[model samples]
Target chain A: MEIFSNLADGFAVALTAQHLLLALLGCFLGTLMGALPGLGPANGVAILIPIAFTLGLGPVASLILLTSVYYGAMYGGRISSILLNIPGDEPAMMTCLDGHPMALHGKAGEALAISGIASFIGSFFATWGLVLIAPQLVKVALLFGPAEYFALFTMAFATLGGVTASNQAKSAFAAALGLGIAMIGSDSQTGSERFTFGHIHLYDGIDFLIAIVGLFAISEVLIFIEHHQGGAAAKSSAKIGKLIPDFCIFKRSIGTLVRSTIIGFLSGVLPGAGASLGSFLSYSVEKNTLDRENKTFGKGDPRGVIAPECGNNAAAGGALVPMLSLGVPGSGTTAVLLAVLLQLNITPGPLLFRNNPDIVWGLIAALFIANFMLLALNLPMVGLFTRVLLIPTRILMPVVAMISFVGIYGLTGSTFDVMLMVGFGFGGWLLRKLGVPLVPVILGILLGNEMEVNLRRALQISDGDWSIMVGSPLAIGIWAIAIAGFVLPIFFGKKVKNQMHADHSEVEMEEVIEGGD
Target chain B: MSDRIFGFFGLALSAFYFWATSIIPDSFMIDVVGPRAFPYIVGTVLAICALYILLRPDAEPDWPNLMNFIEIVFATAVMFLYAWTLSKVGFVIATVFATSYLTWRLGSKPLGSLITGIATSAGIYVVFHLILGLSLAKGPLGF
Candidate 1:
């Protein structure tokens, strides 16, 4: 009864005309960004951060808008995968296994509709799961002390190698680099400058928005430039025969939708296991469980498309649980969201629900509305989004560049910060070329100060005793998990990486053969 | 291999970072753990990771050809120039130059690039400055 009343109050806040408009705008923009091949949720949210600030939207409205984009991007990622044999993002990679085949068979519209419906089912229930789980997780987070919190951050960093990065050593190095960047400003504790290098602008440290936009959006443009020769445009000439799927296919996929949703939701809830893992795991599980003979999996099976689509969307919803409750992001996009919350001076954690109940409940309520909006919007709008794929990179990249420069300048009014953003962009490009994952770096920047503060606090409490780090059982357990999270990845990570590569090549090979024919 | 080169670069960075941390002036009201402690740990971890990378380098990476490399550098230079001249030339003028060059470099015809540049700058100005009421840098001609 209390939960229902809370949700009702939340719905009241979310139903305002302004908030509803923002949600609608976010879903639309998010889908457009998601349909684009390279601009996934993180870059989409990052590029829009300054606009949100300039609009002076309240914390609740800003969050509602951004999170809607997050969910919508997850929904839109399937468009390119089904029609063009190219994934809109990494999580959509699995969709190509069967989605392209469906397109080839003139079921492009059916595939899109089915994926949209499955995504709706997955995200709808997962939002409910977030509603049920986040508050309880907050209760548990309430018990954490400084030492335990420090250990928890370490656990977050340790697990980054498992799911995101290709190499653990490189991931650790990127994290260290991010922490080093965080140390450039005046010390929060002592007001003493650490690495300002005699520059006044360095005193305030690098802004998170500048860093994120630089690393994601700016570097993306640079990459587009370098790879411009090949012109990776989608040429989807497949006829979309029907807008709706056959009833029997939907009936057959009912069990698959439920099973994949559960798998994906759990994957998202786990630290560092994001939508990519969710999609991969759900698709593989469905394939192995149903098609052990491997006859129907990569050969245009509806279940194959349904499984990954459902899983990734569910995982996208599930990723919000840890971020809302514990203040640790569940994925790269959520990390950007966490930065937005911090920028608004609203720290998300156990105290958030108590202190900012309206923002919290309103966001959750808006998520429900956004889900319905996406389901309604995506089905009719598939044709429009497929057209988004046709825009040339020559035009798109310049606009992206203009947005980054203009947005950064607008936010700070400092050409100096703009230059600093460009510097970060170059560094991000270099690191990316070296095969270092950028997410860990962003995570490190976001969480480094907090991690350091917790450690210092714990040490201060114990009178400079290092043993206090392991004094609590909870801390000990978390450290153990951190170690396991780091080490287990080294042993098992190669298999997963190889499998992904294999899948990628298989899809590319099929494309090559199709092109030759 | 590229990894080994990156590893060496990381080592140098970590050494410099550690040296910088050591030279941070001690604050009068510093606690038992100073600001240098966390940075020191970060530098140390970086060194270890870099050392591991140096010892076990990955295979040689696929480097872009010379022309592509030069083009990337040119794009970076254009961005840097745009940032440097943003205030002096104003958002509109500076954006027009940068957007035009970038679009042309990305394979647009000169006329097309010019049109895109003008259109993009005008569009952003209308939306961001006029509608949103955000302040933009004005050139000598002023708004």
Candidate 2:
């Protein structure tokens, strides 16, 4: 009953004309960003962060806009998968398996409609799950002391590789690099300069936004330039026959949608498991259970298309739970969102719910509204979005570059930050070539200061005793989970990554054969 | 192998970071854990990770061909120059040149690139500066 009343209040805030408009715009822009290859939700939100700030949107409005983008991107990721056989993002990889096949069969519109519906269902239920579960998680989080927080942050880093990273060493190295970057500027507690190197700008440290825009946006431009591949424009030859799927197709996928939503939502709640794992797990599980003997699972199977789409979107919603409740981002995009929250001076965690109920509830309500908007917007606008795929990389990359420069300059009015951003961009490009993951680096930067502060606080409480980290059973349990999360991935991660690649190549091979015919 | 080179680079970075951490003067009001303590831990962890990479190298990564590599360098140089000149030459002028060059390199015709560059610069100026009322870098010719 209290939850209902709180939600009603949230609706009151979210229904305001300004917030609603922001949500609509966010969804529109997010879909556009997601339709383009190499610009996933992370980069989409990253690019818009400056704009949100420049507009001076209040905390709730800004969150509503960005989270709408996050959800919209998840919905939009399926467009390229169906049309071009290229996933707009990692989580959409599974969608490409069945989606492109459907597209090849001239059921492209149907595939797009089904995916949009699935994404809506996944997000809708997952947001409810977030509403129910986050408060309980916050109850658990309320028991945490400095030591527990340190342990939790450590666990986040350890598991950030999830089941995707091919090499944990590279992930660890990236995390350390991010922490190194975080160590720049004057020490907050002591006010002593650590890595400023006598530069005045260095005193304030590298803004995480600059690092994010640099690593995700600028590095992307460099990669585009290096590939020199003409824009990944949609093939005019591919046909989209119908806008609506048959009722039977929807009925057939209902079970898969429910199961995938559950799997994705749970995967999202787990720190660092995120949408990629959710999609992978949901797709694999559905295949093993429902399509074990079908022989048509990947041959334009609607269920195959539905499973991963629902799973990833649900996971996207699920990622928000831990972020809002525990101050631990569940995915890369959520990590970037955490940076946004920190920039707004609104630290997320248990207290965020207590201190800023309006923000938390308003954001939750806006997510609900945004999901409906995305479904309505996406279904009618599939052709519009597919047209986005036709946008050439040649024209798009320069716009991206200009936005980064102008946006960053507008935010801090600092030319030095712009220069520093370019440096990070180059460094990020080099790191990517070396097979280092960027998400953990971003996470490390976001969590580094908090992790250090907690550790120092814990030590201070225990009079510099190291044993206090595992003093409580809760802390010990968290540490054990952290250790397990780090070690277990090494054994199983390779198999999962290999399986994904194998499936990818298999699909590509099939496409080539079909093209030949 | 590239992995080995990356490992050595990481090791050097960690060593330098550690030395830098060591040189931080202790603050008078420092707590039980000083500002340098966390950095020291981070540096040590980085050193260990670098050592692990060095000891167990992965398969060699695919390197870009020389021509592709040169193109990448050129693009990077253009970016650095754009950053350098952004404040000096103003956002509109700098953006026009940067976007034009980048678009051209990305395979657009020169005229198309120039049009794209100009259109993008003006479009952004109107949206961000004029409409949104956000301040941007100004040139000698002002608006």
Candidate 3:
């Protein structure tokens, strides 16, 4: 099969000494970034993109490093949840329910070990899921004509704008805005200047690297300043508790791994639910199934730790499926990666299989290696990553800042880029304050061009018959999904929000009467 | 009134999209669709989202950081100066000055930031100019 030979070629690329070293370095750095609280895969990868670009690595090498960091963070996120009751990212939040309590019970070691094994189970299976399903999905993708692509990308944008999080719709908006800004220089279709504003530099459109760094990295720094006067301090704790688990612990929770992996992976593939939902679903499922054990699920149970850890890790892998095959990111992080891939001029979809086999296979292989490496390093290195929490914000920030500056210059040695970074960074800060999620903006920007090109192409074919979108099943299916993606969230999310508010109000009323008496 | 205004804008965008959707030039090679189709859809959706925001304004825009805005403007201004004077002032002076201003804004010590900025500019200049042997454009400001 072509897949095997292509995979072999990817292995040859991945196995080279330079790439091997890069992978290891990537895995190490990825864990370091992942361990940081509140900074998940998206922020972590976005922050260090400049470093990869500065180092002058090709696209393949860059993707491998970034992907490794993504998996590494999933590994490190568990330790924080277990030890500190602080999930490093959203996916790890469910682990905090049982994991932190278990640590207090002196089963921190067991909790951690179980989480490690569960994570390995989740990621391994998810990677294989990608391997088995990617080609088939690619086959399905080939059926999409431009009209279908147009409809699908619009749906992706709609989902991005609608979902993600409550904190920053502007982030997504900003991303799409940035994409539209990038489209300004020369029109790909008409070769006309749309928004050059008389600047010759505008002719080339905006660079994706510059926009990403300015928005994600620089804005992050401004945010840090607003929150911390002196930034996060470094903690280098050298204590490693229990690092390994015996068979008894393994036997007790193997079912949790299987169930959670499936739950996590499936929920993860959905556009809006994301990992938090996945982990929560997994935790409840484990509870319903094992309620008769006379054991508390959330109070310090190993299964509690296992379910979320497995679910979240598997979900990270599952989120990639839609992004890779359909060129639609189910979540914010994948949207950013989608932007990166498009910038490198790789058009993702069924044709990606026929072309760019090296990139597709190489990234896939790197992810497989990243999972195993994460498990191996996590147990022995928990103490070290925990210590990373204490790194002085003063020191880490300056170094990162300098790396960003140097990295931007590496691309065409452009001084003009510094201006763009600072501008977007400030805009990003403003957008954040407005409660706009930056992800959708980027998504809109990314899909804007795709949507535009497809619209033009589709119109040319249909001679301006507006019914082209509704006429075909493939287009109609995408349209239906797009509508569902938008409408379903509002219906269900509103019900949940109202119910939560109702419960809170009842609790408040009860407390008020008692206090008055 | 603000809500109504945003809603009207949303409606306007959607209408504009429908009108503009008709203007895409025909490329008859592919009989399925043309370039105008997606924009027509997105323009329409953006209008819909705009309407959603107008009808249900969950969150409004927040305030910008004043200090960051100042820093951003100064940073952009410095780049403009560099581009205009790159040949005149020479790469080293222009770069050093820009770097100094930025580092100072970034919270470096006045002296340290300036020294380091100059040092960084000079260091890069050395690598790019002397070692790599790229020639700096010598204009009014001589090297």
Candidate 4:
């Protein structure tokens, strides 16, 4: 009765004409931005946040708009991955393994249909899971103190294997580098400046948006330029014929769809394990199980496409649980979401549910509506979505660059931030060239300050006793998981590596590899 | 090898960071762990990673050829120049020049590239300044 009553109240707020329109717009823009090769949901949300802020949409409506973009981007990412062999974002990388092959075989329509259906199913189930589990999770999260929070953060860092480049050491280095970057501003606890170098701007710290734009958007521009030789245009012959699947394809992939949704949702709930990881894990599990002997995974198998597409959408839904319930963002896009919430002076955590039921339930209800909106937008408009790929890289890249400049400049209103963005752009390009992964760096920067703050808080509470780091069973369990997270990758690294290699080779000759960088 | 170069660079970065950490002014009221301790641990970890990278390189580094390397350097310079001049010249002028130059360098026709630069600058300026009600940098013309 409580859940039903809450759902009714949520619908009362979410189903308003104004809220419905915002959700629709968010979904449409999310898909468009997510379909862009270099700029994914993070960019989509980041660029739009300032606009939303300026629009003065109340907190709920703006969130509805932004979250729809997040969901829309996940669905949109599959379009490029399936049709052009270019993943729109990292999670979509796995979708390319089989999705493109299906496209190449002239079954692009079926592939898109199957993926669309799978995304709907995954997100549908995951949203229900969120509705059921988040309240309980928040209750548990309420029991967490600084010591337990420190342990949880450690667990989060330990599970950061999916973001690694070649080896664990490289990933660790990238993370540490990010942590060091996060330490640039004045210390929150001690009130002493850490690494400001006497500049007044440094006191507030490196803006996350500046770092994100530089690392993702500008570095992408630099890479695009470096690789762009004259007369090399993006060529794709994949056409959308029909947007519906027959019963046979549906029946065969039903199990995979269900299994992958569960895997993806669970993975998304983990602190730092994002949608990409969920996609990778689901694909691997399906590949290792259903097609074990001969491994028909990357050879245009519909299940291959279904598994990751479903998993990633589910994971996107799953990722929202932590951010809503505990105030800990599970991924980059969620981090941006958290930033927006903080900017609005709305602290997202357990207390938020009791204090602000309207916002919380409205968000939950809006997500349900957004899923259907995305399905409607994606299915009927498959042909229109494919048209976005025809835009040339030269034209697309410059637009993205200008947008990055304007977005950052608009947010901070400081040209110094623009320059800082350019500097980070160069740094990002160089780091990518040297084979260092950027995700860990971003995560490190995002979480570093929070981790230190919690750690210091725990230590101070215990009067310098280090044992407080694992003082409770929850802390002990988290540390144990963290250790396991560190160890499991070593044992199963080779299998995952081989599967990734297989995915890379299945496409038509690798022309210009861009995603998963 | 590129790894070695990166490894050494990482080492240098760690050393500089450690030195920087040493100079952070300690608060009079000492806590369990000072502000400098986290950076020191990070520096140490970074140094170890760097040392490992230097000692045992993973993959053979693929350095870009002469032309590509030159293009990269030139591009970096253009970006830096754009950043330096943005506030002084304002958004429209800086964006037009940087984007047009980059577009041209990417092999667009000169005239088309210039048009693109002007179009992009004008389009963004209108959206941010007029539509969004946000103030971009005011140059001499103030538009």
Candidate 5:
């Protein structure tokens, strides 16, 4: 009854014309942006935050628009992943495994429709789960303190080794580097310049959006110059089959969907776990469940596609749980949300639910609306996103380049930003060459500030006792799970791969981490 | 391995970073955490990665077309100039040159390239400045 009243009030806020229009506009732009290569959702959201701020949007309206865009991007990412074999981000990497092959087999439409419905199921189910499980999850999360946080951070650091495409030590080194960068400007506790090197820009910490754009967006352009021309959607045909997925096919994978949602949502709720993980775990879980069937999982298996799509989308929502209820972001995108909340002077956490019930509940309601709207938007438009290839690369590339430059300039009237974009582009090109995953860098930067704050705060409470991190059972359990997530890979990654192959013939194209994508 | 590229660049960059860090005056409240510690770590990592790459040239992927390198560098130069010129020379002239170079490289017809360069710049001007209400600089056309 209480929940019903809250949701009714939320409907009042969400149903307003202003919020609805913002949601529509956000979804429209997000799909369009995701349709484009070289610009993913995080950068899309980051670049548009200035515009959102300029519009003087209230917290609910701003979150509604931004979150809608997020859902749209998830929907749109499959367009490129299916038709062009370009995963928009790490989460979409799995989609391309089966989706691109399906496209190759003239089942592009089926793949898109399947993945689309799967995304809707994943997102819709997860949103419902959000309303139901969030308060309970928050109740559990409240028991964590700095000792627990420190332990969790350490486990996050450990898990990152498995999370990345490279050696764990290198990923850890990157984390340390990101932490070092976060320690720039001035140490909040010590009141001293750290790495400013006499440049005033160094006085302020690195703007995560700037670094992200540099790393993911600009870097993508630089690398695209090398291999982008050869295969840019060569002769991919569309499916003329049923636009909606057959329920019989879905019947086989409902377990994958439910299990994946649980796994994905849980991963998303954890401080450092992410959508890619949600999808990966979901795929693995589905594979284990189907082991007896001799199901060939990655050879355009519907379950293969279903698991990740469901997991990633559910993870997207689960990621928001921590961001909303705990003020801690479980992933890079949510961390960006945190930064936006901070900029707007909106405190996100348990108090947010209490103080601004409308914003919290309304934003939740908008996500439900977005999930449905994206399904409608995507079903009618899969062909349109694929048709983008009809625009000659000649015109498209230059226009995209011009728009990126113009966007940088318009957002910040500074020449340095453009140069910074180039520098990050170069660095990104090198990282790509080396096969290090780019998502981790963005994840690191997004969480970098929070990790630092939590570390310091933990120490303050424990009076510098490192043992405080796992002092509570909940914290200890998180630490154990995190350690298992990292260590299980060393012993079990190969075994899991072989078991997977023994059961399901075609192995998942070990996600091309470096350059091939 | 052309350590000349890695070695010279690595040593030079780290030297600069080290020198920059060395200048931070020692304080009475010195603790385990300091500004210099992080940079030194990154410099060390960069030096290590550079060394590994330099030592093992065989590990690098089969190089793409050699001419692609030249193209990439040239494009980077074009973008650098675009950044440099956008504010001073104004967006129009800078954009025209950037678009023309990018289009020609991407295999567009010259006439189409020229039209696109001018049209995109104009479209951007109207969309960003006129429509969005952010101030974009007017070129000599002064619209």
Candidate 6:
């Protein structure tokens, strides 16, 4: 009854004219942005955060708009994957395996319809799961003390190491660098500036917006220059023939869609396992189970197209569970959303349900609305999205750069932040060239403050004794999970590496997509 | 740079970070693990990872050629200049010049790039200023 009333109240808030308009705009822009060759959902959301803040949409409206963009990007990503043989982001790599072949076979319309339907079903199920499970999850999350929180953060980093980056040492170094960067502003506990180097702008500890713009947008521009000058790749001329999949086809794939959604959602709820992992895992599972004879697994099998699309979109919804309930983002885009929340001074956690139910539940309702909007919007607009690719890189890149600059400056009203953004862009490019993952760096910066605060709080409660961190059973359990997270990666590193090598482009796609956010 | 050189650089950065952490004086207000502790712990762990990377560096990936490197450097310098001049020259003027030059470099004709630059500048100004009620920097022209 409480959930029902809360949801009804949420619907009241989300269904408002202003919120609905922003949600539509976000969805439209997100699909357009995500359909771009290199821009991922993270980049789309990160670039727009400053706009959200500057527009003064209030917290709930801003969140509704941004989360809509996040969902919109997931829907948009498959368009390019199926048509152009280019995955819009890492998760869409699975879609490309069969989506392109289906396109080549002149079943582009069927593929698009099936994937759209799958994405819809996936997000629909996952959203319901979020509404049902998040309250229960929050109840458990509320019991966590400072020690448990710290341990959970540590576990997040460990899991991130396993799933995101191949080189554990490099990931650790990147995370440490982010933590070091976060420590620059005046200490929260004390008033001492640790590493400002006497610069006034450093007082606020590097505006995260600046870092995000510099890291993702600027680095992306540099890469854009490299590729654009080399002469752009040929645009796809694939034509859509039909508007919907056959009834028989849809009936045959219902079970696959449901199973993949479950897998994707479960993977998403687990910290650090992202949409890509979920999509790939679902694809593999479907291949083994449904296509035991391997008839049409990757050869334009409609199930192949449907399975991963469902998993990835579902995983997007799933990723919100940890972020909304635990304040721990499960993926790069979610991390950006978390940053947006923190910027709005809305700390996500169990308290969020009690204090800011409008923002939380409004966002949930927006997700439901956004998914439906995307499904409606994507079906007839396949040609429209394809036309987005026709915009020359020259025109598009400059607009992207200008928006980033204006957006960053508009938020801070500071040129130094802009300059810092440039510096970070250079650093991001250098890091990318060196094969260091940027997501972990961003995650480290995002989590560093909370991690330190919790650790100190735990120590403070224990009278400066660190043993209190492991004294509780919950803390002990989390620590064990963290330990397993750390060591199990090492043991399975070789197998993971070999699998990655088998699909090297997936790794490259991950690297490229990092710059989008 | 090769992985070996990168590893050495990482080692050097970690050492400097450790030195930097050492200089953060202990805080008096909060006694139980003050601000320095977190930085110290991060510094120590970073140093260990730096050493590990230094000792066991992976094979190097392919580096871009000098032309591509120069393009990247030039693009970065252009952005830095745009940032410097954004306030002084104001948003429209700075963005027009910067964006036009970027578009030109990326393969647009000079006239087309200029049109793109002007159109984008006008569009951004209209959206951010006129509609959104967020005032961007205005030069003497005062849009």
C-alpha lDDT values of all predictions: 0.88, 0.89, 0.68, 0.83, 0.69, 0.84
User: Cα miss at A93, model 5 (Å)?
Assistant: 4.1
Local accuracy of candidate 2 as per-residue lDDT tens digits, A141-231? 9999999999999888898888766888888999999988898888878888988779899888889999999999999998988888656
State which docking tier applies to candidate 4. Answer: medium
TM-score of chain B of each: 0.96, 0.95, 0.58, 0.91, 0.73, 0.89
Error of 6 at A354 (Å): 1.5
Tens-digit lDDT track of model 5 for A402-497? 766666666667787787777766776765665445555655665555665666676667776667766778788877987776666656555644
- Order of models, best TM-score first: 2, 1, 6, 4, 5, 3
lDDT agreement of model 2 with the native: 0.89
| Model with the higher DockQ, candidate 4 or 6 | 6
Residues B71-93, model 3: lDDT tens digits: 55555556556556655666667
Worst 10 residues of 2 chain B by lDDT: B134-143
The true-versus-predicted C-alpha distance at residue B142 of model 5, in Å, is: 4.4
Q: Deviation in angstroms for A8 in model 5? A: 3.5
Q: List the DockQ of the predictions in order.
A: 0.76, 0.82, 0.17, 0.62, 0.32, 0.70
Ranking by lDDT: 2, 1, 6, 4, 5, 3
Ten-residue region with minimum lDDT total, candidate 3 chain A:
A164-173
Q: How many backbone clashes does candidate 2 have?
A: 1
Each candidate's interface RMSD (Å, one decimal) is: 1.4, 1.0, 5.8, 1.9, 3.9, 1.8
Which candidate tops DockQ? 2
Best-fitting candidate, scored by lDDT: 2
If chain B of candidate 3 is superposed on the true chain B, what is its TM-score? 0.58
B23-83: candidate 1 lDDT, tens digit per residue: 8887777888998999999999999999999999877777779998898889888999999
RMSD of each: 1.4, 1.1, 6.0, 3.7, 5.1, 3.9
TM-score of 1: 0.98
lDDT of 1 by residue, A1-517 (tens): 6777889989999999999999999999999888888899999999988889877888899999999999999999999899988788889999989888888888899999989998999999999999999989999999999999999998888886655456799888888988888888889988889898778998988888899999999999888888883243665444677887787887887889889999999999998798999999999999889999978888788888899999999999899999989998867888999988988989889999889888889999999999999998999878888887878889988899889887788889898999888888888888888888888789888888889999999999999999999998989999998888888878888888789778767867877898799
By summed lDDT, the worst window of 10 consecutive residues in model 2 chain A runs over A229-238
Give the worst 10-residue stretch by lDDT in candidate 6 chain A: A229-238
What does DockQ come to for candidate 4? 0.62
DockQ-based class of model 6:
medium
